[model samples]
Target: MRYIASQIGRSIRIVALSLPLADARDVSQWLGCNANASFNFHPSVRPLPLSLHIQGFNISHAASRFAAMTKPIYNAVVRHAGSKPCAVFVPSRRWARLLAADLLALAAAQKRPGRFLHARPDLVQPFLKRLSDKVRNYVIPAQNRVPSY
Candidate 1:
């Protein structure tokens, strides 16, 4: 992400991030510039809420938390996002496939397009076979480094 930012010479703003034993604020700080350096520590240094969402899909805690959320949570997310495209990230195919079905169903019903991206789509047969072709597969670039690290 930082590489992309540097390439574009634009400031990066993070809306949300989830990682195991990682600090989003510290990451933001590391990537921030001059006056906006403080903004890096807390992506939301401004009064407004940012929209970027990041998470480690395979983390147990994240999975447990997601499990605890009721369907209404998903509904609320879709509702809040309105017609914008939504992306759900998963570290593994098992969870991605499970969630993809539900999300795709929601998108179909809502008439919105949602994406199910996985690091290794080949590992998930169901995802490969059942997922809409519109779902994209993403592989993090090997050299893409974030100051957060």
Candidate 2:
């Protein structure tokens, strides 16, 4: 969308909205916006205040870094998501599976074993059975467990 907008002639005025970016001035220049028209606001300047948490680990290994983050991720979700749906984004499918298993284990250890599982497995079982063996092996056992939430 930005590429297409950038290609538009300057005769047609272009108005764009985006998250606060480090290179916003360059982006404005690329879009043919003059200094007076281009507005670059700090990330903290927002109508609705947003909270962002960034955590870094000193671990050099990729696998070790990911493993170290599992507990922190689980803690953040439990702290912030209070009865609301939450989503966790990971770097790869393998990491996603590993994190999901780790999160489940963490929840279990906290005495909330089914915290992340679906409340109604009967409704989800048919779809689960339809999945291929590779996916089923990773998902079935987790789905079979009762969901307390």
Candidate 3:
């Protein structure tokens, strides 16, 4: 949230701040305000609210998480927890589809195993392969040259 003086006249003041993670190139556009004293407006830009950018997840998302351990939080909650867990890591289908039965089952131990909200497996169509094998192979191999977009 650093400020910089853009032009000469301070009379028609409209400040614009973009997300920190936003590419530095886009800063000008984000802060690019209509600096006419007659037509006054707030510092924030259109579409994105000031509260969302200034006091939101955008700050964290842009930060460099260099060489830091990530999975440990999720692992700590269920895996490394020193108790025999009763449930599953959401079998891929349950994780994807937001079924009420799945939600109830996931919550209560009694309702979990037998009684489900969405009982019929046939009703659910599983997600197909999104990234093809050729793309996967190109991306997976570390040594191979994957073209940067």
lDDT for every model? 0.49, 0.70, 0.32
Candidate 3 error regions (>4 Å): 1-29, 34-66, 72-125, 131-149
What lDDT score is found at residue 112 in candidate 2? 72
> Residues 31-142, candidate 2, lDDT per residue (tens digit)?
7778899887787887654445556789999988998999999898888775556667688998987787778677767767657665566665667656555454444366
TM-score of each: 0.32, 0.53, 0.18
Where is model 2 poorest over a 10-residue stretch in terms of lDDT?
131-140
Tell me the tens digit of each residue's lDDT in model 1 across 1-149: 77889999986774543422135446655666344543323535535444654433354687675665425546655666555555555567887766655665555455443232333433443444443444432211223212221
| Model 3: residue 111 alpha-carbon error in angstroms | 20
lDDT of 2 at 48: 51
Q: What TM-score does prediction 3 earn?
A: 0.18
- Per-model C-alpha RMSD: 15.1, 6.9, 16.5
6-97, model 3: which lDDT tens digit per residue?
34434344544433333443444455533332232343653534221111122343222211212322233334332333222333563423
- What's the lDDT for candidate 3? 0.32
